[model samples]
Target: MKFIGRTVVLLLIVNILLVYMHYKQAGDVIAKDSGTPTYQQEIEVMNRSDALYIRHHFSGLSQGRHEIIWPEASADRSCYALDAISCGRLDASLTAFVDGDNEKQSISYKIPKENSESQAMLYHEPFVTLQGATVTSTLFHITDETRSGGMWVNGLEQVGSKQMDLIDYTFFQGSGGVQDLYWQQNSLPLVYEGEKLAVYGPAGHTEQFEAVDAALKTIGADHSAIVIDQTSIAVQSQRFIVSENADIDKASTLFLTSAMAARYSIPQQERLLVEVVASILGDKAIGAEQSRQAYDKLIVALTPEELALLKEVVNSKAGQEMNATILDDLIKEVTGFKTSYFKTAIQKDTADHLFLFEDTREVRVDGTSYADIGIVLKDGKSLYPAKSILSHLGYTVTANEQSLYIEKEGRKFRFPRKEPFYVYNERKFDVRTSPFEVLSDEVYFEESWFRRLFLLTIDKTAETIDIVNLSTVLEEVIE
Candidate 1:
């Protein structure tokens, strides 16, 4: 009896070991089968190769025609290279190879002459664009797509303490012109100079205005808001605030946005806007000179009323005393400024015909006809009540705090509150307008829900919301 009991215990231990070994083996097999390099890894590898190719080809390709080819798939499975060899003529005509997934594509440019001066026209071809990198063509030529020339990036002989990624160099053969194009990874263009373009990025975290320093004028405003009395009786308060860390470009952008939104009809009104912006950031190191230049150009253009308004806001003791509240004040003084958030109204069309469902049933909900059922605002956006539409289509509709749930067959869709985006079949889409509003006890959604999700078309001519039921169509075809 003791021997038999020991044998049973041994068998149980062996079975447990076998089960453990089986799972380990299965896990190893799964890992081996699913070991493809991830998409992000592919992107990184491609970017590095682009850098390499650009470096190798930057100066000039071989003088004669040659075909360059790389494999469609990288050996390490890190990046996707192209499979086909690209052939192009190099002597009389210029050919450009555009990089793409799984294939090589080429575009040709006409070279007027064989001399180096002729090659300067290569810049006319749109240089290659990368996802996180920008390359600017300055003086030289582009033979390679990846690497910028190694020296003097963005005017610095060495990159120094500042950060820079790539610099491409090209020397014009006889013109003795040296062009330097500089770019940094994941940042704005450092130094980009092309034809009809001169743009300079911020030199440091802050900038000092050369004109402000030369003029030797000191202006300070303690507060952001200023109240000006053109007279003792007519009192207006203008508030414009600028943050300490805010640069001139940002100030200009904010000023542009407010001025544009103000919708000023007259050029003088816009000039007043510029003055307000200048007064707001005039003390700052940046934008002061730019503001002054703009003011000089616009000063001659202002009418007497606009000029007086500008003087009242900028040159007066009240204007000087006025501190941070300049933005609000200038916007208010603009000709057609509106304070409301939503400017456009919902738009609707006149209903020419009555509505019916596919089954020949007149569509009605809550004593409202189909024409009255959908609300079209002046913005050309429309919405229909979810409960009414879902019920007519035989869908089970329910609502929760976060979303309105609609289910038909085995498919479910969730439309969230106050979100212009919706989820269907586990996919999210921007339906142009959020179009979802909850009024009292009912939920409403845009007409896009029916057109996009249910694949139904709203026919204004037929005056019917044509429900394209695939099953019914199939059934009719069979009959």
Candidate 2:
């Protein structure tokens, strides 16, 4: 009887063990089908997903050059927020992704919810709001769901490279819940000023090409741009002479790089082409719609008298063209604006005595500074100097029939209003009232540039401006 009882106990133990194994296999199947990971299967999908951004400390990007930046997340960002800037103050989310060996063992992580775009001085971590499975719930559900990319080796890190052209990649912008999208070209051709250009979209459709039309419109290329089919982009410009054999692939690089660098690789010749184009096209490169809006915003930033004075300046040939040239150069040289996008790199002034204006990016200095930089506003056919803008900041801006003059901070500047006008730099310039130009009555500096070019022309002492002290300038106007 004792032997029989012992045997029965052993059989029961074996039966229980077999049942456990069978259920474990069943659980695995269910997890796969339900899209829910079992306790051990979470990492399996991760390894399979090939989330390449894991290699980066900033949001790991999966493809085309990603401009992933570190973050400084905050809750009350209103104090430092600007409409042009999408990001505000914040702490670091400090997000991370680590690879592991287990296929079935699940590893968990929390993705940060905030997407900060405005550039700060340093790459700071964002604040993490959740952890574990809840972490995924709190973060955004953005995905390259198409899974349409192959791995591309970049730097020491390998990232997933999508087979997208630069146009499609840099055309759209993703902001919080809103998305801005545009079409793309398979291959694009670039036109540099002084070069003859042939414009076409897809299937060899050549319509209006070069800066012929873009230069005339006050708003610019994005709005008046001629696109061919769904693949080609033609941004009109007055700067370059186009070659009949201009290659589209090379030009595409110029447009792509000028628009977004991380998204495309441009050859040196193409870069030269962009510089030339930017030099001639100036602010007219921004779509007409955008320029109109910019003008409206800037008007709000100015005082009643300042706006009036600015209007007068924009009407002048020198004011219109010079400002357009300066504005476009600043955008391309600093913040890049292309077909439908704006990619800006915000850097703080390195000079110890310099600070950004509390309300804007314009630099300011305390004490006595010789140089006074005034942002020229576009008003009608004339370029307007905001006399009120200069006066409020303790500068005296005066304009006569033949010239625009200013004494601000400590520097003095004189701009010729009519033809045969030469900057202090003595470079030959054109004050053309071209019918096919953005500013019909404005003067364009065919051979001159603002500060960057100005500095090259004029010899000057280095001085810093305090943007901090200028905060009051905006405080009085914004309200």
Cα lDDT for residue 344, model 1? 9
Q: lDDT of each prediction vs. the true structure? A: 0.33, 0.27
Per-model TM-score versus the true fold: 0.22, 0.17
The residue ranges of model 1 lying beyond 4 angstroms of the native Cα positions read: 1-378, 418-420, 427-435, 439-441, 462-470
TM-score result, candidate 1:
0.22
Residue-by-residue lDDT tens digits, candidate 1, 71-148:
222122111122233332222222223332322223222222123221111112112222221122223233322442
Whole-model lDDT, candidate 2? Answer: 0.27
lDDT score, candidate 2, position 369: 38
* lDDT at 23, model 2: 25
True-structure Cα RMSD, model 1:
30.4
Per-residue lDDT over 351-383 for candidate 2, one digit per residue giving the tens place of the 0 to 100 score: 111111111123343333323343223332212
Poorest 10 consecutive residues by lDDT, candidate 1: 37-46
